[model samples]
Target: MKNCPNCNAEIEDNFELCWNCNYSLTEQKIIDIKDLNENKKEIDCLRCHVLMLYSGEYKFHEGPKIGVLGNIFEAFVNRESFDLYMCPKCGKVEFFAPLQNSEYKFE
Candidate 1:
């Protein structure tokens, strides 16, 4: 097991990046689109109860700002908070959270 420099979380040796804090020891960043897409899950809207489609496409300093809550600076880099779920029918959206080992649930 390797320790992540950003969050200090224990990462699998096979994983190229840190899943907890997006830490990278390598210079070339290889984003696993399939793994990332599977990160978002769908659920009923809190207010409207409408079905939403969670989006996971965003860019840092251009899209949403992540880990900006409080004085928390757990990561070395600022990443874009990808909108995980959205209800186009109701126009509701929710940001993605750190998820580990949870299989993507699509409804």
Candidate 2:
């Protein structure tokens, strides 16, 4: 295990990024997460009432099935992806659809 220099959190050796704090072990600094676009909306955590930081994109993958019918059904299912955001203070996570594909607009 290794300790994150930024947050002093214990992390696994294989992981390059610290989960508690967005510190990059390889870069030896805190990562600066960029906005998705120029008009990207700032999300605040409901519990902490603090700004949430964009973690990364996550995608759902099809898992192995037990039968042929299950495999067929899985083929027709659309895998969903979302942008992950986490509250820095409370560590609460929230998922949002990609900004470009979302129908809801933020003012």
Candidate 3:
């Protein structure tokens, strides 16, 4: 276990970001795709018919505050970061959870 530098929360060593405070251990505020893996295939937007650009990883600081019902739903889908992608032609965005200990597959 490791302590988060920002929130001082105990976190597993395998985690790169903190679950409590959403703090990233890496110095870069936004992770660069080039630094990850060059061989990762690009995603094409369905509407635009053009390659989508990797934006960055996104983490929520807190569960969204949309009132009582939103709070209940937040518990089910909380403390997760997603890979963000944007289509230049249509300005459409998409997100996916990063795979762990596995190869990225496009379908």
For candidate 3, the per-residue lDDT at 72 reads 68
lDDT of 1 by residue, 29-63 (tens): 53343444464665777876654554655545433
Index of the highest-TM-score prediction: 2
Q: Candidate 3, 3: how far from true, in Å?
A: 49
lDDT, each prediction: 0.54, 0.72, 0.64
Clashes of each: 3, 0, 0
Instruction: Using lDDT, give the best candidate's number.
Output: 2
lDDT of 3 by residue, 1-107 (tens): 88887768787776665545545687624344344435544887889666666767787655466776876677676476778876544567898877642455555
TM-score per candidate, chains pooled: 0.35, 0.51, 0.44
- TM-score of candidate 1 against the unseen true structure: 0.35
Error of 1 at 59 (Å): 3.0
lDDT of predicted model 3: 0.64
Would you list the clashing residue pairs of candidate 3? none
